[model samples]
Target: MTSPGLPDLHRHLDGSLRPSTLARLAREAGIALPVQPRFTPGMGLDQALACFSLTLSVLKSPDAVRLVASQIAEDALAEGVTTLELRFAPQLHGGAPPAVIVDAALEGLAGRGGLILCGLYGEPPDLLSRLVAIAADRPGVVGLDLAGGPLPSHDFSMSDYEHPFAAAREAGLGCTVHAGEGRPPAEIRVAVELLGARRIGHGTTLLEDPEVVALLRHEEITVEACITSNWHVGAIADPMDHPAARWLDQGVRVTFCSDNTLLSATTAAREHELAAALPGMTPALWNRAVECGHQARFTRS
Candidate 1:
């Protein structure tokens, strides 16, 4: 909230859990962490991801989930994010029901934002159905998103396109997909055309296919670009090589985000700063990207 304007759309709840809370929960859960104490600071992509296991270890019970969910909203509000789509995989939380996380997030959010139930790439159809049910029942739950590890667990096949995404849409749930990160640009096409992805995560490779770019722009799809997280995950070797600038130049809708603030140790202000530095990026273009997030958010009410 200090510098970046009042709305950051793409933030992960699990990734933004507070350090002090994690330490306390770890102590209670008897989970050992790295010597550094802080979950952030110079970690390889796998290591940063492994930190989630530690977070998941502690965020099992409803009280734990509620506290962490509330804290995440507090941090986002502090970052000037009046509204955001906080995504997390409830199934990853030691069998905690999706309702617990969603309701807790709603309580914490206090109507400030919405929750996006994450369907991890390898999950079975039944799980996504349950997620869709939860989202459909909860008005504060905004949508469904397909996310996976550095490598996508499921290919962009018909089965992948159908299951949760189509089912969720059929049940009135919004859709977004994590594509163009570990997969090819064509997969981004599949996500949009087949799976109904209104937004894309880490869409750095989207420009690899001109046709895909046209489809994205023509559809007015929003790309959530996480510059630091992309470099940390090695999706892009250099932040300077990021296509956000080019996408903006082409009048493509793009939004900057801190994919995992807990792991990346970044804030909306920091993300805006990094986004402004993209080679050939202009201040006007970057401002438009911020506005894109503000305008593209899925607020059902």
Candidate 2:
């Protein structure tokens, strides 16, 4: 079971849609369900994102997004996740204005969890700025995230995001960025120093640089580690080799998460189990990791 009070701070709502939900929504919309993206071991970044695209194809309307959001929350609660931050890119949902998408998702969340609005990589600056604006003053909106795969330019610098993220911070929203997943490890430093991220999503390459790890520990930045998803997406060669436990031992806060529950076919509980099985994980360390997760939550008292 997911440790009670342990928070999942890095879930992607769009990628967590249930197969049954997808089928029902497809039928209701008179849209055929696209071919399921088969998960090959180590399918790599391009193919992993392709899976999310398939799920997005079914979510054509805010109502559809709302339904999926509610169901995903229920599923998380069922799995014993006491707190969650379910994130999604509103701009990817459809032509509906971002506010509409945010409202639909917030309604579905129903106070069961907080929402993190995502600004996808490669999205136009104007669209990203609008997304940041939409997050402000929204009830149930606790955080803002920079997510998605690498842009064609392979640029993951903070230059394009600094202004909007500053606006996000000004609005009192917590900031978390998807850095070091497949990007250069230096980008993780940029995220914390420039973008003002308090948490990092899928920091797969974090341990590659000792300086970066030290910076995170010094700043109390949490790393959202998705073990199974990392292995499946080729971010890590093997789940056992993941450095989640090592990070904890090194004094960095770490949290286990199921990045895309449906896409990775895992759960919050399973992620915890994987973390526990890592080489340096002790019972005390495991408990501390759980405590760190609750500490890292963006929701305010």
TM-score of each: 0.91, 0.94
Top TM-score: which candidate number? 2
Off by over 4 Å in 2: 1-3, 154-157
Model 2 lDDT tens row, 1-301: 7436657878888788887887777787787765755455698877888777778878868888889889989999888898788999888888487799899999999998899999877666567678777876685898888887666685444567888888888888889998888667888998899999999988888888999999999999999999988898788889998988888999999989988888888889889988989998999999988888888989632
Error of 2 at 94 (Å): 0.9
CA error at residue 215 for candidate 1, angstroms: 0.5
Q: Distance from true position, residue 66, model 1, in Å?
A: 1.1
CA RMSD of each candidate after superposition: 2.8, 2.1
Residues forming the 10-long window of minimal summed lDDT in candidate 2: 149-158
